[model samples]
Target: MRLSTVILPFRRWHDGGADQWRRAEELGFHTAYTYDHLSWRSFRDGPWFGAIPTLTAAAGITRKLRLGTLVTSPNFRHPVTLAKELITLDDVSGGRVTLGIGAGGTGFDATALRRPEEEAWTPRERADRFGEFVPLLDRLLSQDTVTYEGTFYSAGGAQNVPGCVQRPRIPFAVAATGPRGLRLAARHGQAWVTTGDPKLFETGTPQQSWEAIRAQTEKLAKACADVGREGDGPERILLTGFTPDRPLESFEAFVDFAGRHAELGFDELVLHAPIPDSPFAADQRVFERIATEGVAALGG
Candidate 1:
């Protein structure tokens, strides 16, 4: 299992922000991702930087580490604008960028820009929008000029000159568990992402979480089969921290945790970088040790 990490966008660049990304590369992480939010939960009141800018800066400092958002959604983004930014970011990173995208949840992002009279999108509406969003974003990134119209979004002769540094655009790591979302991932993703089932987070056992993910992979395989890509689906990525398993408690724990997920067919495992005084908080030393030694232990 390849090891990766998510570094929450809670720090300012001048105040040791760049150092964390630089250190991520030094520690040999495959990719260092961040939350793509205007402001995330709990950290809403705290400093949260823009994902594109943070990634551009990280690209400037790191030579080999891949950079990406854990998942950017259509919550507050238009496909045209987001595609332009991603193309620039891909060039900045020298093609070392991945776009982990999802159909956003009903968080502050859902209503952050809405007027008082405007209601947030319902689950059905969110799903409908995502179905349109991903395909259009795909076209906008891969094609030179796109002119299309849809219920939730549109493009009017939008132009992306010279396109992405990564041919056919940067790799998309689509985050999904639902059938329609999985279908999208199977059709368009270079990687499929999951955090297990959030419903099981509170009361479910770790064994149950593993089973849930196993079921998800099965669904993904079925989705790929439907699209005539059976046995050659996107790479599977499990973003840890939402589930009950505490993989980073120690090097041994991470190895065991990663090994089990590997058995479930996950190609990569992502742990959150240690955060102080938060739910994601963990011992920094342990996190570093895992980054340095955990992958070798897992024979990554």
Candidate 2:
């Protein structure tokens, strides 16, 4: 399974930024992901460096680690503008870019964008808009001139200056959890990443969370079959969670979990460390240990 690391810039963990990203490359991490949050939920609002700029900086620093936003909200920026930024970043990264996007969830405030709360659309609407927006963006980014019109957006003879650096097409992935969202991911995304409570595994034998993930995968695979897509369908299915504060007594549990996910046809497992207040002292020993032993157990 491919392992990736996520950086929470808002927490200010790494001081050297690009320099630290280089260090992560040396540690065998394949992809480096980042988060985008306009406001600090309820606490504060400040001049935060936007997702595109931060990704550009990381791309400039690292040689191999693929870069992507963990997930960007459609509410913040129009799909056309986002496609342009992603293509530019892909050029900067030497085709090492993956677009991870999703419908806006709770925590995002559109008021800053001058849109009222009621103006906020439901998750289903956002997903539908995203479904429409992505294909149009893909066409625009892939070709010179494009003309299209949709319910939410329209363009007439729109031509992007230069196409994306990625030869075929940039890899696209969606962060989804619900049924509609999962179906959307199967339809459009090259991968799926999910994180939340463990209740999803509580079945008869206390394996509800794992069962839920399996169920989602089955549903997604059916969607892929309906569309007649080829090759193991989506190449990756990333599961994110915090490691226990205490060391796991039996690594067997994790081994079994990985095997179960593999049986369900997941290609990767990503574990995000809890964000620490300080930069250099985040205590990565646990992560390092998992990389060393647990990865071996899972045959990564």
User: Candidate 2: deviation at residue 244, Å?
Assistant: 9.8
lDDT of 1: 0.92
Against the true structure, candidate 2 reaches a TM-score of: 0.83
Clashing pairs in 1: none
Model 1 lDDT, residue 82, Cα: 98
lDDT tens readout by residue for model 2, 92-166: 999998877776665554446654646666767777777777677668777777788898877688767677788
TM accuracy, model 1: 0.98
**Which runs of model 2 end up more than 4 angstroms from their true locations?**
11-16, 40-48, 196-206, 242-257, 277-283, 292-294
lDDT of each: 0.92, 0.66
lDDT by residue (223-242, candidate 1, tens digit) is: 99998886669999999999
Q: After superposition, how far is residue 133 of candidate 1 from its true place, in Å?
A: 0.5
Q: lDDT of candidate 2 vs native?
A: 0.66
Total backbone collisions, model 1: 0
